[model samples]
Target: MGTTTEAENKPAESARRQKTRERLMDAAFEVFSEVGIHAATVEMITERADFTRGAFYSNFDTKEELFLALAERGYNERLELLRASVANIDVIMPTLLEQNPGSLTATELGPIVASFLEQQGDNRLWFLFQSELRLLAMRDPEVGKLFLQQKHAADQEFGNIIAAAFTAVGITPAIESVELAIVLMNTYEASLQEAIMAGGEKVQERAHELFMQRMLGLISQLAS
Candidate 1:
C-alpha cells in the first residue's frame, strides 16, 4: 500500500472533527438542560461527551459559544420541520379538503398549522434549554444581543413559512406574517410551559391540546 498523503487524509480528518463537535454539542445540550448555563461547566460537558477538556477547547472557545450554537441548532431544526410541513401541503391539503369540502375554517386550519410548529425533540429539555438561554440573555448584554439576533433570524424564516402556508390555503392574514409568527410562537411556548408546570404523564399531549385550543381562537381572530 502507498503512504497516505496529507491531501487524502483531509476528508477523513474533517469528518472526525465534525463528529467530535457534534458529540460535544449533544453532551452540552443535556448538561445545560439539567443545569442552567451559570451552573454548567466545561468539565461537565466533556465528561458527559467522554472527551478531554482539550477536545472541548479545540471545538469551542467558551461555554457561551456552545450555548449559542445549541440555540441556532434548535432554531434550524424547527425551521426544517416547518419547511417539511409546508412542502407536504399538496398531499395534506387535499386530504383536509376531502374530509371537509369547503373553504377551510379555523377548526380545519389549526391542526395543519400546529403540525408545522411541533417540536421533534424532547419538549421539556428544549424548553429548559431555552429558559436557560433567556435567563442568560437577560443578565448579559452581549448574550442578549446575540440571542435576539438569532431570534429575529428565526422569526423571519418562520414568517416566510407561515406566509407560504397561508397563501397555499387561500387565507389572508390580518397581520404581518412576521408579527403573526411571533404571536403563534409565543402562544406555543406559553402553552408548553403551562403544561410542563402542571406536571403529568402526558405533558406533551396536554401541551398540544392546549395549543390547538388557543391556536384555533387566534386563527379565528387573525385570518379572514
Candidate 2:
C-alpha cells in the first residue's frame, strides 16, 4: 500500500495515533510538574511518553503548543466537573452543614464553600497551569488571550450563580458578588500554585480550610 493508503488500511492506526498523542501529553504534564513550564521540552516529554522524536513532532509542533493543548484540556475537564457538581448543590449543602460545620464560619454555608474548595483540590493541575499563563500574559499575547478568555468565562459563571442565589432570597444581588467571584476564581487558581510550592498536600488542606471560612463567612454575611 502507498503511504496514504497504508496509513488508512491499518485498523489500529487511528487508535495508535491517539494513544501516542496522549502519551506525549501525559509526559509533558509530568515534566512540567517537575521542572515547570519554561523548562519542559519536547525531548523530556517524548522521553516520558516513550515515543520517538519523530512521533512527538508528528503529534505536536512544539512544547508550547503541547502545553497550551494540555492546559485547554485541563480547563475544559474541570469546567465539566464544576458544572456537574452544582447539580447536587442543594443536597451537598446539608451534608456539609451536618458533617463539618465546625470547620467553617457557619454551618449553613459550609457545604457550598467546602464543596468548592474540594473541587479546587481536584482541579489543582489546571490551577498550576493558570500560574504559568499569568506569568506569560504580557510576554505572550496569544497565550494570555486564551487564558483570559477562560478566566472571564469562569468568573461569569460564578457570578451568575451568586446572582441567582440572591434573587432566590428575594434580595437584589450586590455587584460585589460578581467582583468577588472573579477575585475568588483568580485567587484560588493562583493560590494553588503557591501551595504546590510549599512542600506538599498537607498545606493544601489547611489553606482550603482558611479560605473556606473566610470567603464563605463573607458570603453569609452578605446574604444576611
Give each model's clash number.
0, 0
Across 63-164, the per-residue lDDT of candidate 2 in tens digits comes to 888888887877676666666556555554565445654343333453454455466444565555566767777689998898888777776667666454
Tell me how far the alpha carbon of residue 152 in candidate 2 is from the true structure, in angstroms, after superposition: 1.4
The residue ranges of model 1 lying beyond 4 angstroms of the native Cα positions read 92-94, 100-102
Model 1 Cα shift for residue 67 (angstroms)? 1.0
lDDT of each: 0.85, 0.65
TM-score on alpha carbons, each prediction: 0.91, 0.77
lDDT of 1 by residue, 2-87 (tens): 99999999999999999999999999999999988989999999999999999999999999999999998987887787677667
The lowest-lDDT stretch of 10 consecutive residues in candidate 2 is 101-110
